[model samples]
Target: MRGLMGRTAICILIILFAATAVAAAQTGDDAVTEGNITEIYSTIDTCDITLTSSSTIEDLVIDVQLVHEDRIIDRETLNVDRINANSRTIKVIRWNVKTSEDGAYKVLVQLLNNEEEIASKEYGFVHGRQVIPEVVIEGTIANSEGVTAVIRPVKATLVDIDYMLVDGTDVIYLAKDEKISIHTTPLTVHKRWNTLLLNNREYTGLVKVRPSDEVNAIVVTDSFSSMDDAKITDVYKDEIGASATIEGGSQVPFDGYVRFTVYDHDGENVVESVIMRSPILLTGDDETVEAIWENRLREGKYRLVIEIIGNDGDVLDIQETMIDVEKSVTISNDITEVVEENNSSPSFLITQAVLVLAAVGFVLRRRNIR
Candidate 1:
């Protein structure tokens, strides 16, 4: 009786194993190929899911759930008519939460075919407070035709920028809806105003930066004057002196001098400095002024900084040029100048001839007396 009972138990266990194998064969080898969850904003989350199948599936249903601390915060269901064999499908899901506090969250997803579970996936994320961007206008630079606003962002942020050039109460130029990404570094944005179109006067520059998450925009205002009417048009240099031609524009008269400063090849040592006073320049007038450094330069390289200074000691324009001295002028030019001076003086020649005749007569008279 004991041997018969043991055989019956063995038969029952074999039958159960056969049933489990048959169920697995019918389900097919479908799987969740990829899945991820990311917090895009403070309260917005996106889930990306990919499903792949080895065999065709009919009436596919995808169930997605967002859970926090064992509680279902949100649930979404997706339906697809069919998925071909040896193919994959992609689905995107988004969830908006009411809180922005830091917390652990999960995206639970399940893929089913005809009420049979085929694949499942879970993605976890920790939501944290989003960083709001902040920026400040460091300064403004003005040129003859344009203005540049220097901005420094405190953090990485997306922002809209606006620039305006104002003349007294009138808006002369305006730029709006300029979008840019700013990092933790200085950024310069330039806008052309063509200050030559307007009279020489003081103008106000305005810059506005608006962050996406902020309600109010940050504003910065600075004053910059239109370029002075006087500008250096031509530069001429030699070993002894540097000369520049100053041209006057249509607006104002220019009464300035040119200051020439000489520096070593590396611009580290000051060699010499001189100033050449220029006549008052009227509109549409150009004049050349030269500054002689006196000390001739050797055969080498040097840097010349020329500044157009007004009568009021205001610098109107500045320029820089590199001078390569090929030949030394001290020996050759000085000797030539001395010979020319002696030859050009008629009085010195006549006096030397008279002294020669007088010496010859004295020698003859002394010999005759002996």
Candidate 2:
């Protein structure tokens, strides 16, 4: 009876193993419910399709067909794996098809479950054989004097090329694959300078021409002070002379010198005047003062002018002053007095008169030599 019980237990274990295998197989099986094409390419032979399944699937077989007017033109088959059950996933399929005919075609994608159509999706595809061109131009723009205006890029394509300028009413036609460069002019109207302007038509933020090079100008301002205020009493020949503080202007240090133009109101030309040289010094607030003026000045009323210049063709500032010049003078005199109280010969007196007349003639001749 014990042997009979052991054989029955072995038979029961075999039936349970078979039942577990059957359940596992059912759970792993999958079926597709819907399929649809997502995208169709005109240049490249490619199409994307989305497929939905009814259950969790590990593998799937897809077939793609291209049809024109109910006639099959191309057909391809693809195998995919690791797809989720009851979920939608995108599958991309590539195929070689003749696109010489400019017409519409239909794409049919089918998901197969055990060699049976479980899901299908359709899409429309069109092909056109045309060449499109694009054009781009990049450069700098300046005014007539080569001053910077604006830098910009001009782009044009054949598809959409109609544009109007911001300040003018001119219609610009940008051809396909065509690039152009235009130098914009600075507009001055009503005494107001407009840096940028439109063409014939009004378009906001039109192409602006900016200066690519640097710009420079000259600025002049004048000031005056006395040497007494400058605390300069004596001036040497070789050394730099007095200095008068210049104020109320914008000046840059290490630029050009402040030329001291001294003019004598009593003289005819500039040669009768004197000029002083000065080195630049740093001051506050964009102002520079120089102790470069020469101290050697003659006694007279003179005019002083200072000018500031830059290396980049820009004049920053200028100054002018009128000063009274005074110099020290020295004089030496010798005098002899004679008294005729003692007795003297008459002939001696006559000789002395003759000698005096001869001396006067000699002095006159020396004056003529000069």
Candidate 3:
């Protein structure tokens, strides 16, 4: 009876231990609330993953595996200790996974407690390759009315750009394999004055052309004498049927004079004349001089040469300018006439006076005849 009792007690103890083990396995020693795979690479045979758990655990183990078909290509495991409670723990497990393999992969990570899986995670992976090219534009030109000038073009290359062109105030995008043409129109006199802009870096030039017809005549005004010193201050010219005001020296009015000359395209002298004039008269510290001229001019292209004359009859400054003469408009005739009935003029006061005098004369004649 004693041996039987001992046997029963041993059997009860074994049953209790098996039940406790089953309960512990069901509850799981560590719970993986979150698991994440951060980065994956195509060329390199590696991946990075992060793991988080609810409570601190000991002997924490992570496994990385790549399953291909029914075979496992690589497997790795790492041990982590004292993972903090409700905190993330990072474990880097290097595996022999081949990136060149043209197949799908599965990464499996497991947290083990006493050689038993308490939490597990799985993810998918892929491997391949790709690339891209670049392009850009380098320069531009302006052309109009058979005349062309180099305008600054875009300076870029195909390290990243596909192709480019400038339109209005924007850079337009083009295909990788495309040709580009850039051009601008010349400025009109009615629109903008003549000017030139150059791009020094790109060795490009832009010309602004103004509309003009022909030069007509050259007129020079009389020289003016300064108050302090007899120096010329300003000069005047009657050009293209209009007067042009020219500036002279600041101090001397009589010391400055202007010479006007006009030449045609064949180099023949058209108008050769000189006028010494001071347009501004500065007296008592006042800095101003006035010059005026009036002359009739014809319509033609002409070159105007202006020379400033010193008091000693020496030329001080000279400038040559081109002028174009435009046609002028003229009104011809005017007439005033009145159409009247019965030979009467169209005047109310004259007609009323005539009627009043006729009535008075008739009354007088009737009284005389009686």
Candidate 4:
């Protein structure tokens, strides 16, 4: 009779647990407890995405994102292991303090239940100031058309300019500082002010310009040609590095530079590089230049990419080649033998004789002077 009573008690407990889970499911009281970043001196940069639930929720995804103004500085999405009923949990994400551009930033944390956003909150706070890139407006020139500012950047960034046309205390604000993102070239940013402003009164101008980190310029060139068709001849290795003879011809005479870049067998990362500049080939000239890599690379397969760049930043020719580098005792022995042969060669003997003669002549001249 005691065994039967024990079995009945177990069944009753299971039913009660099911009923409790059903009731909890009907009342999904889940909320994001904290989405705002906790305030601290700029030393620590951490954001907590905390949530509380009245019932256990499985596989709930939480996405925490922090943005400085419109730019997303950091974002983290996580699938919560599980949240216990009537319990709270917190997930933490690290913030790169470098992204905080010396001012208050807004943060967003959203809790999603089965792909539906159930809870979300936004937070904002101010951070200490930092040295950021800016546009330097040295001076301005004005005419009846518009005003132009002599602008240069203090950092690699983009700058926007606003101008005011003033004619004898008649201040006419033309264009506000319109932010322009640059990613074409790191060359100096100079925009001419020629846009027509309202009111035809001729006026002198003053300008204000601002720089932003989001805007940057990238160096690009179409004239610099990759050595795609370059033929690799006589590729060998000695004490210096991997050496190769690059053979190609150019149809147009150009002032340019040649570069040889080598990558590992994967051809993803550069392992060695060599560049030569000036006195390039003439028109319709077949060119041959020796490219010697100085990096001490281990014995392995490597990919070599050669590029010819014109003075105007254009690619002229490009080619790819594969090589296997090896360091062997036999190679060293062969090199020594070749050196010995070269030292005893007729041309080498003639060079030594000339040097000895020159030294003797110098000594005789000194004796006569004495």
Q: What tens digits encode model 3's per-residue C-alpha lDDT throughout 1-370?
A: 9999999999999999999998887665423342322332211244444556565567766666767665777877766665565665444333565455665667766666678776676766544323111111112232111112222222322111121122221112122322323223221111110222111111111122111221111111111222212222333333422223444322233335555666664557665454746444222222233223244455656676666565567775666666554344332232112223323554754675576668668756643442
Model 1, span 1-370: residue lDDT tens: 9999999999999999998888776543224322212111112354445555555666878788888889888887877566556665555454666764577777788777677766676766666545443877788765435567787888777788766666553345666655688887888887665333444577766566777666445656667655445789999886778789998753334666889999999999989899888776655578989888778887788999999887567887999998777642222355445546789788876776676668668756643442
Candidate 2 Cα deviation (angstroms), residue 275: 74
Order of models, best TM-score first: 1, 3, 2, 4
* TM-score of each predicted structure versus truth: 0.32, 0.26, 0.26, 0.25
List lDDT for all candidates, in order.
0.67, 0.41, 0.41, 0.53
- Per-candidate clashes, comma-separated: 0, 27, 30, 16
The whole-model C-alpha lDDT of candidate 3 against the native structure comes to: 0.41
What's the residue-level lDDT of 16 in candidate 2?
94
Tens-digit lDDT track of model 2 for 1-370: 9999999999999999999988877654522133322333222354545555554665668787888778787887877664565565554444577554766778877777578776676777555534221222232222211111222223221211111111111211111112223234322111111222211222221222222221111111111110100112222221233243433121123333434455665534442223333343222213324444434556666655555444233444555555565443332222112215312566766676676668667756643442
> Model 3: runs farther than 4 Å from truth?
1-44, 97-99, 129-370
* Stretch of 10 with least lDDT, candidate 2: 220-229
**Please, what's the RMSD in Å of model 3?**
29.8
- Candidate 4: residue 352 lDDT (0-100): 57
Among all candidates shown, the one with the greatest lDDT: 1
Pairs of colliding residues, candidate 1: none
- Cα lDDT of model 4 by residue, 131-244, tens digit: 453544455544432344455556555566544443332232335555665443332332223333322233344444446543322111011121112233444443235444
